[model samples]
Target chain A: MAEESAARKDDDIRILAFLCNWCSYAGADLAGVSRLQYPAKVLDVRVMCTGTISPYFVIKAFQEGMDGVLIAGCHIGDCHYLKGNYMTAKRFQVLRETLKFLGLEEGRLRLEWVSAAEGEKYAEVIRSFTEEIEKLGPSPLRKKKAEVGA
Target chain B: MSDLKSLIKEKLNDGADAFLCLKEEEGTLLPALITDADSPDLELAAVGEARYPLGKILIDLLREYPDKRFAVLVRGCDERALIELSKLEQVDLDRLVMVGVACTEEEARACGCPRPYPSEVALGEKVEAAPGRETIAEVESLSDAERLRWWKEEFSRCIKCYGCRNICPMCFCKDCALENPHLVEPGVIPPEFPSFHVIRALDMAGRCIDCGLCEEACPADIPLRSLYRRMQEIMEEKLGYRAGESAEEKSPLSFLGSEQDIKKLERE
Candidate 1:
């Protein structure tokens, strides 16, 4: 079991997480403050709004060798900008479908809504997401460009 | 094609300052912007078996000669491009008249045109062009793993040639997102899998008019039209919208959205 655990440690998976500043980002912060034990595999980038996360940003993450991507935004009717998350919903839907059509696994991209109060939920999400990426192995893009340059 | 010539003459008499269409010069078809009635260029005004970016040329003409009214030859896809261009404020549709030309059945089949003829076809017999989704079907049939491997191999052949964007009539932005180094890494060959192509496909969601020009221009022979058609399907399915279907209806992406859209998007 020690050797098996060591083998699991060798599995390299990089997950890029984009959290909205208003809700999801604060929730992640709350998780950190609460000492919620979750895997540290996620690289968090906070945006003012998920609506501003152009499909190209997600594409660039995948291209740069991210094994998976997580987009967590404000809940419906809870956008700090009133309707920013509405646009996020539409764009994300289209982007996800386009990615799927282009042959990326639908599981590789995920969208969720996390409130600032839901630190436990955010931790739970990251734990599950990290496990999922582990099962999927390293990204094909990562394998090709092993250095995964900036 | 004689009727086409007579129609051109009629339009010239009907107040159009210039007629822009394909003119054969020594058996080579090229776009000719004919302004003089007796210039003999009109003699070569034949709709030869070639497609040019007539919409792009029209945009230039409209910009240069703002006061002049011009008539242009438009295939079905060209018509859609102009309609979408007008919506984008790239072209003033009011000052231009469209001369519709229908693609022959053979050309239509080869090009996979859904509507092979323009709305008001003035040339050729209207042939029913069956839109083939063979590539879409094949790709859809693949398992998720197979699909990923297939696309990785296909996109690996890209030489980063901007022919797809250069020839696309709708891509008239002063600063194209594709060229933005931040969006698409400048020096990377194959431009990092999925990003280069995904950026384009997202932009094309409610905008691509199924011209097949991008595929024709593609050196790597990427099945761009099929990919775009799938984008169109998602747009229609999710928002009940298709690009260039009507003149006044705006793309859902353009607006913030109605309350219904927000609710629907939230649920989805």
Candidate 2:
């Protein structure tokens, strides 16, 4: 039983990452051109700004059984739209605090600053985040076959 | 006091079909609909210790008879409820005549109500009630761990009777998050800790009118009002919006207003 459970844990982790169109998405595109090797576990959604991400989206991601959520945005004061990152910063601060208050493991969600010029930084951030989430195991929110009455 | 009584009598005599207010029945105060203009039961309009949710009762009565027009005595909280109900399309505000009553100093103090009276005054003396900031102060003083523990303890006693939701004048939704088994597991006493209460607080962001009826109806004596009141403060601070303050202003979450609101989210 232990060996079987260990084998199950080896499967790829499902991660949902929100990339800002001006910074994170561009950095990810650059990483692909640079051929920087990283795990392909991430599913990315590109939004006009990281500030566009609602806390509801994060909650919904978990509810949908994503193992982790990554929110990558422009560096503070370096936003393409001038101060967009400021709103993202404040919202994530409150959302992270609120999620922690609800007894959810705060490590499952991460916020990082990735500039359009920093393709290597984006790749490194993704690699580290994926490793951390893989070590943390699958999200408790995932529905088990028996739990679903299947 | 008799002057106020005569004023109510005069209003009733002036073709007011019925007045909605509280009447002491068997030593317990309940909302009563008095139809006869000359009925001596107008004596029941006297301000007393017991409080009834006039808005809730009006919804039931208005639903039962759609064509009838009724006049109701409105306090600050009652007026707020009426405003929200009008927004929810539960009540026809134009059809109802409002006879506003100001709260007494003692009553104001008990409620810590900022606007203890309605828009137009028909009775009682207007006195400014100092808004009590103590509840917020107490919660803010606690560390994150302490705050979490405090809320968990308070929420642990929730009977899941949904008296709070049922009694809320603003809660008119046919589907409720608290009732949803996916978000909140059903048949669980105290309701899986924070999910039930947190969902309620989130939902109350732009709707709660600070009526205090939820806390009043709670069988476990939970401080549900303080939680919702804090959420109201957060909405006003973050979005500059207050529920029931104006019919023209839409809720912050209901619609994405302008580029500023969307931009503000990005800046954070």
Candidate 3:
């Protein structure tokens, strides 16, 4: 079984998630505490707010070989800073359109709103997003295996 | 061309502190700031074919001479840049007078400019709009993999020269993102694929005036203008906003708007 799991690791893909500390991060923690089973392919960075997530971060994540990127924050009108998520919505629209224009698959990037209480929702988001990314295989912009290892 | 010289002289005598225009020197046109009406350099003030980021220079000049009023020779793109810069608080529109010169038909066709004349024409006749959509359509027609390959091949030729940024008139940020080590790694030749170019394209989204100077300045012949023009089109399609086209309203992306605005965007 250990050998089989090790073999599976070679085909594993990486995803970078930017979660807001106010809502999405707490929601992710709830998922962990509730023992929810979600895909382990996602590695998350907790930001103070989703507004702090620059479009550059998304671009850099793709350029650095991540198969997918996810941005989650408070629901509209529920931001800790009152209006941070509004900027996120606006920036995400532009960034998504930009990535699409650049020929990247639309499924590679996503944005969601997960409240701190929605642990099940958080887990389900990860599972569905992971499944979608798996179907797309590796990113076209991913660095070669040798380059990543180096 | 002599008409521009007299207009400059007239403005200089009419309480305007100085005039900023191009003058032929050693058979090449260069920017000249004439302070005296009787200066011999006034005779050399000719609206040459070559274009410079005169608005960028005007920003510095206005800041340096805070109390002086200046007249500037402007083409369509220059006027648009100054209008946008004024919105950004980089230029004092009240302190500067614009002398608009319409581009010739041949010049307008060469630039692929949509609007080649300013609001008020001081010289030359207005030409028909020649929009450049061929490149944008070409990229759109290609498959995703083929499109990526095309851009990568074009970008790989980049020598990391920042000519595109330096020549941009609307670019006025003191601390440039292009130089940031975190965004663009230092000492990397060809600058990391899609990072450098896409960063620039994103930054130019609602800011670029589509002047075509960056493409002109590019030594590697990267289609910088086409990239930026598409960005402008995206802004127009998504937000119904175009840079340098308005005098009252700011770019929606530049502000923290109301909940109603968010709702409208979400529905779309």
Maximum-lDDT candidate: 3
lDDT-sorted candidate list, best first: 3, 1, 2
Ten contiguous residues with the weakest lDDT in model 2 chain B: B254-263
The residue-by-residue lDDT of candidate 3 on B74-161, one tens digit each, is 9999999998899899999999899999989988989998899988889999887868799989998988788888888889999999
Instruction: List where candidate 3 sits over 4 angstroms from the true fold.
Output: A1-10, A146-149
Candidate 2 chain A TM is 0.88
The TM-scores, chain A only, for the candidates as listed are 0.88, 0.88, 0.91
lDDT of 1 by residue, A55-76 (tens): 7888889876688999999988
The TM-score obtained by model 1 is 0.92
Candidate 3, clashing residue pairs?
Answer: none
Residue pairs whose backbone atoms clash in candidate 2: A51-B266, A84-B266, A86-B267, A86-B268, A87-B267, A87-B268, A88-B268, A89-B268, A90-B268
**Model 2, residue B249: C-alpha shift (Å):** 1.4
Write the number of the candidate with greater DockQ, choosing between 2 and 3.
3
Any residue pairs clashing in model 1, and if so which? none
Predicted candidate 1 versus true structure: per-residue lDDT over B18-88, tens digit per residue: 99998999999999988867868888888888898899989989999999999999999999999988888
lDDT tens string, model 2, A1-150?
A: 557444655355889999999999999999999999888889999999997886667766775668899999888767888867666665565456455544456788999989888899989998999899989777765656574454
Listed in order, the DockQ scores are 0.61, 0.13, 0.70
